[model samples]
Target: MSKLTPLGSLPYPQPTDVADVPLHLQSLAEAIDGRTVLRFTDIANLQARVTNPVAGMVAWLGTPGRLFHYAGNHWAPVAPGPVHKVNNNEGSTTSTTFVETLTSATGDPMAVSFTAPPSGSVIVTVGAYTYNSAADGLAYMSAAVRLGTTVKLAAHEDRSSIVRSAARVSASTQFQVSGLTGGALHTVTPAYRAGGGAGNTASFDNRFVRIDPVT
Candidate 1:
């Protein structure tokens, strides 16, 4: 007779039991037969080792230190990845065409880059302190969050004639972008434009862009 482990049901001989080599071998086989998680150096190593992983199989990736679970056809992250953020307060613009809110002295757009998981989604949040130049009609500032050149979220603030000219306001927008290519680098930028009126200068300061990858 023997006692068995509560979780894995592994058998161990008791004081009263006779020598049981077959039972001991069976217990050893069971111990290593079904592992809860497999460890690998990285994604390339994991794919090389696990060519035909089944559903619900879990793996630990060493390079990025993340956990992944196989979901029948593809490997999915067990949890959301790290968040990325960028902040700038040095630039202002009055361009009617949408342009980067943060830019270098060389006129290059400032951006935040992050790696996305396979078929994953990211939540993007963009915010800025905005100023609109005085005008007889409506004075407005329009801002947007862009994934590369594609605009994902856009927001605007309109100051009416009664609200005083040259008003400063806070504009922000948050949204999710999905269907991203797995293990690809993605960039996010905050952009702005002036309202469709003459002398309606739109300027932004103290702006930030945050990206949160979702599993």
Candidate 2:
């Protein structure tokens, strides 16, 4: 009697089975390594600064914005100076004072972000509200850009104030701007509460994000 193997071939240490050897050859698959990969250098950053604007435009890229810090927030030339940095609330707050400088006593809050404007332009949106203690009211606010006492850019009634709780529900306004530079001095233009801080606690988050190039 002969011993049998699983494939009808005699079992051997390394499959040296002799009983079931094929007369002809069979296609064998080559062993493949575990991973595939690729890599390349990033050129977008340098391309714009070095290459012509037309070439950068062909790639659908635009000139980068001027970056700077102001009024306790980060700003970029992309949106003039209305946008804000991550920690817009340089300080904390916990009050109902109708003050513009968002602080803890006046409700430190964050502003929603906006799209960057085309080169040489800035824009911001704001709403207005009445200084009511119990419920929110419709009041107007102003956004102005200034440089050492000189108002370089101005947008009125751009953003509206809201009850700390209602801010998430209300729609935001936008301020359009042009003729500004990242190197210039600027601020959110300011939002003045018409009446005054009502007993009701209304908070404001005038923070914004600006996107542009690094120069």
Instruction: State every prediction's TM-score relative to the real structure.
Output: 0.58, 0.36
- In angstroms, the error of model 2 at 204 is 2.3
Give residue 22's error in model 2 in angstroms.
76
lDDT of 2 by residue, 156-200 (tens): 443443333333333345545666554443454444443334444
Best by TM-score: 1
* Clash list (residue pairs), candidate 1: none
Regions of candidate 2 where Cα sits further than 4 Å from its true position? 1-83, 86-99, 103-119, 125-132, 139-142, 158-170, 181-185, 189-201, 205-215
Report lDDT per candidate.
Answer: 0.62, 0.36
The TM-score that candidate 2 achieves is 0.36
Candidate No. with top lDDT: 1
CA RMSD of each candidate after superposition: 6.7, 18.3
